[model samples]
Target chain A: MKTFFTTGKGICIVGIGIGITAALLQKLGNPPNMGVCVACFVRDITGALGFHRAGVVQYIRPEIIGFVLGAFASALISKEYRPRTGSAPIVRFLLGFFAMIGALVFLGCPWRALLRLAGGDGNALLGLAGLVLGIGIGLYFIKSGFNLGRSQKTYFSVGLVMPVIAVGLLLLLITRPELKTGALFLSTKGPGALHAPLLISLAAGLLIGFFAQKTRFCTMGAVRDAMLIRDFHLMKGVIGLLAGAFLTNLIVQQFNPGFTGQPAAHSVHFWNFAGMLLAGLAFALAGGCPGRQLFMSGEGDGDAAVFVCGMVAGAAFAHNFAIAASPKGIGPLTPLFVGIGLVTCVVIGFTMRKKI
Target chain B: MMPDRIDARGLSCPQPVVMTRNKMDTSKSCSFEVLVDSGAARDNICRMATGMGWDVQVTEDADECILVLSKK
Candidate 1:
């Protein structure tokens, strides 16, 4: 069958669908400016699993489960599933770790940056600029032939691991498995407490997963392709996403245009940029956005699964160390950690370049 | 004779480029015109057209551009 979703118009529709759904999810109480954030959702999942003791940001987000499962289902139906691994797993993990840290500092990922902007958070501009700058730097490394090495095909079970984990998480979410005190913490308030209904959230995630899998959607990829090859295909989808979300926010009366008082947002402009700069650099090095990583994990990429695990661990570290920023403002150690992250990424970029 | 024209204004990035590419691919015409809203899209389409062995002329407007491509 001819796949319409892979075409330019189809991708635009997919972008619109994602944007509208995110806006609707926000209206349905999934937190303002945070209708769907892969990094934040993963952090919440990490907390729910008791990986971190952050009391205010613990929940088993079904959207994440749906992302993996939905992508798995799409891959299965399309016969596109190819389990693979062994591509500098440790480095990928470190990249994911720093990516999560950067995201936490900014309180958003690339996807959330656009969502925040569409919802009228002017502060997102700085973060967006940082993302572009970071990606531009990553492009230089790419031009210099920086590679993480090649991945080899692995057993089919390797591909099923992430999906199985997702299923296990969904089961835990549904059963509310009683654990001893301090075993599994549930947030009673804050961003972790904010959620759309489980089924609705799962459905939205599944739809996005299916479409994103078909379209190979990635915000980082969009920017990379534009800068490296002057290709605008992916950028069009991004523009579509922004336009769709903006229009939906306007219709829903959720558009609050300002830099201050945006939910789950901090107005410290410099850290916002620096945070995303770190995240964008990490994502470029890792070769996909957080959402793309999850999608890849679903399709049986064990390396991507490793990266996902690194993100979970990074989330724990962020909350435990008080490095994550809050709505009030930047954390005390944000600058220090962001500086470290930038140095680390630059070192990797330089050391990993293949001598041609 | 008037050349075929595609007014892809207000369309996003690749859409404008894709539309221009599609028209060029399907038509046997030697010359055509495409109107786009963004500088990026205008430049991208021109690059693609040039790579495809087409002569290109771009006329800029306030926030839009018209690219005329002739087969080389």
Candidate 2:
């Protein structure tokens, strides 16, 4: 069960498993295609922490916590836990920050983009296109000599930071402590209010975390590889995800296709494209997608830890600044933030190059 | 003649393979060497190059891998 399955077929199986699990989660009461949205869950966690006062978006999700702990356990079991750090960590943090901003602007991550498509949400097509373009731009930078530099071996304890935090969060979720400071918020009437059973969410997250870690499942990497090398191994995994999710959705009779009135999604085509463009570029720059970052953090990469923290912080900032989108439309400052994120990503892409 | 060398150390997976593919895309340069630091990169390059009708010979040197791809 805890084996490193990095082969093409192995990754495809993992993808299908993730897709089915996510569909089931949605049916069980997650926010639509948000069954496994890394970005949205991080955003919800920030709200629960009282980082932003978004009433309808506050909840400590067990799935997020499970993702970290599960990957940590998997890496430990597989003897692949390599505690390492020091490769432009600050840059990675900023990349993750902008990545969250972009995801919220689009109202989802690449995973959600795929899940949304599988759920028969037509808007996901634009987001997927934007993701491809974004990765393409990032690949251009990569081809023109961009590197995050090399990381060094670090002490074992350093890598355990994210897992410790995960455990702490899980405890908070379980205890549901009533702090005097009005923390540990939960939404009574929004996407944050909807969730699958705690055990189920946690189990699905654990399975996803374990498999993703073993296979190195990354949505951005899938698109990048397909485009850059004309190799479709990772792309096969993406196809598997879509197929699995679609099949599950059909079985549940939850397939609904249209541009308008999609759950937790907006019809603003421009922002959808630009938002994911920024997110995709950020993930590419950071060397992994959001889920991959969490998995790496579990395995003891301090840089990945920093990136994950940046994402959490960015979620807070997004909601606080009113830059995150809602079903109604784009946030007022979304264009500003998305534009800034795009420019920042481009600058990072251009400036962080090693001499070829 | 010394084969063209592309040092992909520190770059993530598929980048190594992508760069190697770029080199192969040019008809004039059929043989090249890639310096990658991870087993994943080495394996990916081997897998991709082998699929592209190129032979990959991997040699290890001090925390890095040298993947030499040749068409002839």
Candidate whose TM-score is highest: 2
User: Where does candidate 2 stray beyond 4 Å?
Assistant: A1-4, B1-9, B18-39, B55-72
Q: What TM-score number comes out for model 1?
A: 0.83
Each model's backbone clash number: 1, 0
Report the C-alpha lDDT of model 1 over A1-356, residue by residue, as the tens digit: 22676567877888888889889999997988888899999999999989888888899998899889988888788666768788779988888999999999999999889999999999999999989988888878866767676567678898999999999998888888776676556789988889999999999999898778777778987897788667666777788888888999999999999998998999999989999999999888887889989988887778889999989988998888889999998878878888888898899889886521
TM-score of each: 0.83, 0.92
lDDT of 2 by residue, B25-48 (tens): 863776788888755577678768
DockQ values, each candidate: 0.03, 0.34
lDDT over C-alpha atoms for residue A182 of model 1: 62
For candidate 1 chain A, which ten residues in a row score worst on lDDT? A1-10
Model 1: per-residue Cα lDDT at residue A71? 85
Error of 1 at A133 (Å): 0.6
